[model samples]
Target chain A: MSEKAPWITYRPELKVLDCTIRDGGLINNHQFTDEVVRAVYDTCIQAGIDYMEIGYKNSPRLFPKSEFGAWRHCDEDDLNRVVGGHDAEKTGLKLAAMADAEKSDWKVQVVPRSESVLDLIRVAFYAHQVSEAVEMINHFHDLGYETMANLMAVSNITETEIDTVLESIAPTPAGTMVIVDSFGHLYREQIDRLYKKYAAAMEGTGKEIGIHAHNNMQLAFANTIEAIILGSNRVDATMLGLGRGAGNCPMEILLGFLRNPKFSLRPVIKLLQDHIIPLRDTVEWGPLIPFNITGQLNLHPQHAIKYRKSETKDDFVKFYDELKSEI
Target chain B: MSEKAPWITYRPELKVLDCTIRDGGLINNHQFTDEVVRAVYDTCIQAGIDYMEIGYKNSPRLFPKSEFGAWRHCDEDDLNRVVGGHDAEKTGLKLAAMADAEKSDWKVQVVPRSESVLDLIRVAFYAHQVSEAVEMINHFHDLGYETMANLMAVSNITETEIDTVLESIAPTPAGTMVIVDSFGHLYREQIDRLYKKYAAAMEGTGKEIGIHAHNNMQLAFANTIEAIILGSNRVDATMLGLGRGAGNCPMEILLGFLRNPKFSLRPVIKLLQDHIIPLRDTVEWGPLIPFNITGQLNLHPQHAIKYRKSETKDDFVKFYDELKSEI
Candidate 1:
C-alpha cells in the first residue's frame, strides 16, 4: 500500500485503529518482545492509526496466566513502555485492554489503580456474564477510563440475551458498547441492522458506539467501514491480519480507506515485512482448510474451526452435512 | 472468504460486480491457461457475482501480440469456452471486454464482429481522447452489444472535459458512461462529486453509471463502496488485485462487503488459493515503491506507475519532492 497516494478519494468517515501487536499476540502465545511490540506500536502510530489497543490490562496477579481472557503482556509496566515513546496526537490516541467477566474483580483491580495505565479498559462478557461485565464498566467510568462492554461470542447469543445485557448497561457512564464480531461471519446488512439497533438502544444512555471485527469471512475490513459510515466511532484492526484463525481486520488497509494523512502505510508494511510475515512462517493465521469448509457450507464458524483442526476432510464434510441435515 | 456465512441483511439498492479474472489478466499477459480461466469464471458464478468481465474482444490482426490492450488469449471462443460451461444464472450474467479508442477499429473490426461474442462492448478512452472514444461506443451500440463509454484517465480530467465528451455520447444509444479512475488517484470526496455530477448529467441524457477504480492509495475498494452506497450501479474489479501497479479493486473483498449471498466467498477464495496466489507469487501487481511514495505524499498515481518502472526509489523520492514542491 502507498502513502503518497494521488488524488484518490479517501473516506473521511473511516477511522483506523491498529491492534496488531496486541490482538495479533493471541496467535503467538501472546508473545511479542519489547522491540517487536515497540516497533509495531511506533509503526502503527506513524501509519496514521486512530487508536492503538496495546493489550489487555487484567490484573495478572488476580486473574493469573492460567485463566482465560487474561490477555498476555498486559501488565502496567509493559503497557507504559508501549504508549510512552509516542509523543503524538493527543486525543483519540487511545490505549485499550480487555478484562473477562466471569473472573477478575474489575471494581477493585480495573478502576482506581489502572487509571494511570490505561485510557480505555474494555470488559468482555459471555452471553450470561453481562452483570459482571457491567460492574466493571461502571467501575471504569467512576475511575474515568473510557469503558466499553463488549458482547462476545455474539454468534451463539440471542437477541433477548443481548437486549438483557443492553438493558443492564442502559444507565452506564462509559463511552460505548461494542458489537464484537468474534466469529467474523457478519455481512453488511447484518452489521447495519446491529449498529442501528444498538445505536437506538444507547441513544439516551450517554454511551458511544464502537465495533471490533475479526476477518473470518473477510468482511471485517468492509464491515468496520460500514459501521463507521453508519456512525460507529471506533474500528479495530491488527497489523498484517494478525489474530486468532483468520486474524483481525487489517490496520493498514483501514488507514488507507480512512484516507487520513495522519495514518501512514510504510510502518505498517514495515511491520508486515519484518514481523508479521516472519510470524506467519511460524504462528500461521489466515484461512484454514476447516475454516474454508465452514465458509463454503455457510455454517456456524466455531464448528468449522473445531472440526477442521480435529477431523479429516471427509469427516468435516460429514459434520457439515450432519449439521445441515439437523437444521 | 466462507460460504456458510451467518445471515446478513444487505442494502437492497446495492449491487456488486466482480471483474477479477478479466482485468487481472492485464498483468498476466492475458494468456491465462484454459483451466485458470474456467475456474475463475466458475468461481465468479458460484460467488453469485453480479457481472463477470471476461476480457477484451477486438480484431486480433490489429491488436497484435506486440501492442497493449489486445485480447491477449481472450477472444470470442475464449469467453464461450470459459463462461459457456457454467450453470448460467437468471441473476443476469453478462460477459464484458474492453476496446481502445484509438486502436481497435469499431466500425469494421469490433462492433458487428463482437455482438454475438460478448454481452457488452466497452469503449475505453483517455482523458483527452474521450470524443474519439464515443464514436466507438456508438458503433458497438449499433451492433446490438450493451455499449459503455469508459472515460479513462478520468482523475486527470475536469468536469468540463467530461461534459464535452458527454455531449456527443448523449445522442447515442450508449447504455452507460463509466467513471474510470484509470490513474488510481481520485479521493472519496472527489469521487462523490464526480459520480453525483455524472449520474445527474447522464440521467437527463438517460445513461446508467459505471465505475472503474485503481488501488494506488488503497482507496479503490472504499471508493467503489462509497460510489455504490451513493447510487452508482455498475462496478468493476479483478481477481487477486491483478493489474498495473497497485492493481485494480479486489474482487473477493468487494464481494464480501456486498449484501448478497450470491457473492459468497467460498469459491472465490478457493480459486484464489488454487490459481490467483500462484499467479501473484509468479507475478507482482500491488504497491510498488513509487506507488507507495505517491500514496504517502498524496500525489497522482498514474505518474507513480510510470515512475516505478523507470526510476530508483531515491530518484522516485526526489521526483515526489519535485512534484510536491510544484504542487
Candidate 2:
C-alpha cells in the first residue's frame, strides 16, 4: 500500500520464476520432449527471468520413472542435459526444482548444489506438513542451495492455522515463503490479508513472500499482480498458462505488466506460440467450468480434473450438484 | 482502502446487471433465438439479479434491420416478445437497454418509458462524446427512465480528459456513470484510479459508479470484483462471458462471488450449461491470443477479430508482430 501507484515504479528485487515445465508437467506427466524443454530454458534466459523451476524431485517409487518424465526425479544427469552445468557465470538464470514435503525423499534425491546444475530447491507442503517443509528447507540450505517453502492450498486453511504456520516458519533458513493458491480459490481480499500476515510474521527474518497462482477462476494473473502490488518479491508463471486444471498465470501477461525493461515479452510469446499453444491439442488444462466450481468451493481440483476428462465435461449442472452434495 | 475485508460482509445496495443479450449480441449480430433470450431473462429473474439489459436502442437505419436481430433496435414489441411487458412487481428484475451516443438516434429512436417496457436507458459514449452523452442522459431522465452514462474505452483516455468528462457528466441526472473497459486493456490499478476519480467527481450527486469490463486480458471478473471492493455498486456481467472478442465478465462467476442470499448461483449455472455453452460452436468469443495482444496495447480488438476469422487464427506470432508495428 504505497501512496504512489505500484505500476509507476519497478522493484529490482522482484524475481520472475518460470514454472512452465515444472507446473505444465502436471498435464503431460512431465513428459515434455528435450526440444521443448530446451526451448523453454533458452526462452527463460532470453526473457531475463530470475529463476526457472525445471521440475520436481519426487520419489521414484510414488511416481514411477516409466510413467512420468525425467523431470519428476530431476537427477544430476537430466539437469546437466537441459542446462550444461552449475556455472552461474555462464547462465544468469538460476535453476530450481520442487520437492514435496511428504511425497519427496528429499534426503537422498536432492544432491548438493555443487554436484548438480540446480541452484535452488522449492519445498511444497500442505498446512499440516509445514514442519516437514521447514526440515526440507534446512536440508536444502545445508546443501548450499537457496530454498523456498511453499504452503499449498492456503485458501482452505483457517486464519489461526495460517498464523501458526507462519510463526513456525519465521525462523527457518528458507529465503522465501510462497503464497500458493493450489486451488486457485483466493480473491484479492484474501491475498491482501494473507500477504499482510506473511509480511508481518517474516518482518525481521530476512524472508520474502512469493506468489504461485492458478487460473481456476481466470484470476491467476490478477492475483499475481495483487501480490506484487503488496510487495511480494517472487512471482511464478508458465508459458500460455500450461498446467493442470486451470493452468498457471501466463508469462506473457505477467511480462506485459512488469515494466522492468529487463523482462522481454517477445521471447515468452515466441515460446508460447511455437511450443505451448500446440501442447493444448494433447494436454487438457485451463479454466473449465468444473475447475471454476471446485475453485469457488475451495475443494481439491482433482475431482474436477477427473470430471473434465470424462464424457460429463459439459454437464456442468450435474457436476455442480454433485459438488454441492459433497459439501 | 477499507481496513476491514469487504468479502466478509455483503453490500445490499450492490446491484448485479446481466448484459448477456446486449453484449453477447455483438458476437452474433444480436441474432439470438427467442428461446435463448427468454432463458436468460428467466434465469436473471430467478437469480435475483437487479437489471437485465436486453439489447441496444441504436438506429435501425444505421445498423440495418436486415443485418441484425430485432434486439438491435429493442422495439416495444420486441421487449414484449421477450418478457411479456416487464412485470417488475412479479419478477423484481428491471429491464434496461443501451444506446450509443453517435450510433444511436437518441432524438427519435428512444421512445418514452410509458410506451416501452424498458426501465433504463444506458448511454454509452467515448471520452470525446461526454457533452452529447450528458444531453442523452438528460433526455432519458426527462422521459422518466433511470439513466447511466457509460464512458467507454477508458483505458485509452487521459487522466485530465477523464476528469473533465466526469465533471461534465456529474450534474446530468444520470443515475450511474460506468467505467467501461471497451478495449479490455485495464488492470486493477487503472480501475481503482478510474473508480476513485469517478467517485470523487460525482460526490454528493447520488450517482453510483459502474464497471463494464471485457475479458481480453482475462481480468474482467477480477476487475469487476475490484470495482465492487472500491464501492462501485453497479456491476455488469454476461453469461459465460459471451461478448465480442474476449467477452464480458461471466455471470456465474459474479454471482458466485456476491454473498447476497438472494442471488443464487444454481440458476446462472443452469443458463450457462443449457444455453451459453452451446453458442460457442456458432460464435467465436473469449480470450484468444490476438485479443490479449490488442488489449495490452490498448487497441481495439477489431483487427484481432478479423484475424481470428482468417485461416491464421493460431498464428499468434504474426499477429504480435503486426500489433508491435502499429504501436
Candidate 3:
C-alpha cells in the first residue's frame, strides 16, 4: 500500500510525450495539415508536455514523397516550415520523430542534431530487430540526439524473446526503453510484469522505462496508468487518442491522471476540441468493434483497419467469426 | 503470482450481467425501442451471459410515464412485452432490474417472484441510504427474488462511511454487494482497497462482491478487470458502453477478458452492430472530454451531460476551466 502512494504523490521524473501526429499518421499516411501539427505543438508547450513526436522519419526511398506526406520523411525544411524551428530551450518542450527499423535510412536521413530541430529519434522495431535498433540508437546518440528503443508488439512475443531483446539493448545509448503495446492486447497484469521486467533490466543503467500503448480494447490509458503506478517515468499519449487503429492513449486523460501541477489539461482539451475532433469525418479511429477484436486476439490492427474501410465494415459478427477461424 | 493466476484459469462463479438497457436508459429517458431490447435479450441468451438487467423499477409517481419510457418504471407488462415473459430456467439467462432506494415504490411495484419474470432486484443507494437499501433488499428477498445492494458513488464517500455501509448490509439476505463507481473517478488503487474491504466485510455472509464501473476516465473495463483480479465474482457491463455520461464498462470487452468458456463474443458483437450502433445518431455516450473532466473532479456527470447537449458542447477548454474554478 505504501509503495502505491505514488498514485497520489506523483514522481517528479515523469515525462509526457505527445505523439498525436506521429502515430496517427498510420491511419492517414502522415497527411495531417501543418495547422493541426502547429496546434498540437502549441498545446504541448502550454500543457507542459515534455515531448511532442511530430511524425515518422522513414526514408523517402521506401515511402515516396509523392505518395506520403511531408511528415513521413520529416525533412528538415518541412519540419521547420510547420514549427518555425521549434526551440526546446525557449518552449520547455522537446521534439521527437519515430524512425522505424529497416524502413528508415539512418545513414543519410538522420543528419547531425545541430542542423535539425528534432531533439529525439525514437527507434521502433520488433523483437527480432533488436540489433538494428541498437545500432540506430547508438548512431542517433552520436549524431547528438536523444534516443529511445521501442520494442513494438511485445504482446505477441515470449518472455525469453523480451529478455533477449532487453539484454541486447540494455547497454545502448538509448535514454529510454518503451514497452510498446502495438497490438493493444495487454491488460494491467501484463503491464505490471512488463514494467517490472524493463525496470529490472535497466536497473542502475540511468535509462527510463516508458509506456507507448494503443487503445484497441480501450485499455491504453488504463494500462498507461498501471505503468505509471509501477514507476514508469516516460509516458506517451496523443490528443483525443488520435493514432492508428483505435489510436494511442488520450493526452487529456493522461494529463488529468498525473498529479504534476506543471501539467495542464486545458490545452490538450482545446487541441481536441479545435483540431483532433474535427478529423473524425475524414479519418476513423477509436475502440471500434473490429479494432477491439484484433486487440483481444493479439493480432496486428492492419486487418481491422482494412476491414473498417470495406463495404461491410459493420458486419462485426462476420469479422469475429473470420478472425476466430484464422486463430 | 499464484493468486493472480485467475487471469488464465476460469472462475466458474464469475457472473457477467449485461445492464445495457438498464444503465443506458439513463441517457435517453429509458426510450430504447422494444426491438433493441429484444435484440439485447436474444444476444444475452445466445452469448450465455449469466444475468441481464432490463431496466429500473422506479415508481411512476416520481418519474411520470408520460415523460419516461416503460423501462423506467419497468412495469410487468412492459417487461413481458419486450422479452416475451423470459424464463430463466428455459433460457438460462436470468432477468434483473434495478430499484433505487427512495425513487422506488418497491412495496407496490415489486411483484412476487412467481408473478414476475425478473429474478434479481438490485437495490441502489448512496452511503447515507444504507438502512433504506437494506430494507429494500430484505423486502425484495421476502418477495422471493435474488437481491443485490449497490452502494453508488463510493468514490465520494470516505473509507469509514464505506465500512459502515458494508457492516450494515453484511447481515442482509442480499446475495451480492457492489462497489458502484457512479462518478468513474476511482483508479486501480481505490478499486483494490474497496474490493478488499468489501470482501472482508462479506466474508462470512456468503455475499459475493461485484463491480459496477463507469467509463468517464475510460477505466471501466480496466477497473472491472482489477476488481475481478481481486476476487470479484459479479460484474456489470453494457453493450458498447451505452449509459449515462461516459457509460459503463463495455460488455464486449468484459466477455473477451473473462476466460469462461460459456461466454461468446460474437453475439455481443452482433448486438453492437445490429442494434446499439444505430443509437449513436439520437443519443450520445462514451468517454467524451466533458465527462472525463467531471470524473476527474469527482463530480456527478449531470453537469457534463448537460454541457454535452449545449450549443457550445465542443468548447472543452471552457468546460475544464469552469469546472476547475468550482473545485
Best candidate according to lDDT = 3
Fnat per candidate, as a fraction, reads 0.04, 0.59, 0.80
What does the TM-score come to for chain B in model 1?
0.83
Clashing pairs in 3: none
- Number of clashes found in candidate 1: 43
Q: Put down candidate 2 lDDT per residue, A72-137, tens digits, no spaces.
A: 889888888877755555767999999998899999998888888888999999889988988899
Model 2 chain B: weakest 10-residue lDDT segment is: B1-10
| Residue A30 displacement in candidate 3 (angstroms) | 1.1
Candidate 3: list runs displaced more than 4 Å: A1-5, B1-6
How much TM-score does chain B earn in each model? 0.83, 0.97, 0.98
State the TM-score, rounded to 2 decimals, of chain A in model 3. Answer: 0.98
Worst 10 residues of 2 chain A by lDDT: A1-10
CAPRI category for model 1: incorrect
Question: How large is the C-alpha RMSD of every model relative to the true structure?
Answer: 6.2, 1.7, 1.5
Q: Order of all candidates by TM-score, from best down to worst?
A: 3, 2, 1
How does residue A185 of candidate 1 score in lDDT? 62
Q: Report DockQ per prediction, comma-separated.
A: 0.12, 0.72, 0.81
**Runs in model 2 with CA error above 4 Å?**
A1-5, B1-5
Which candidate, 1 or 2, has the higher TM-score? 2
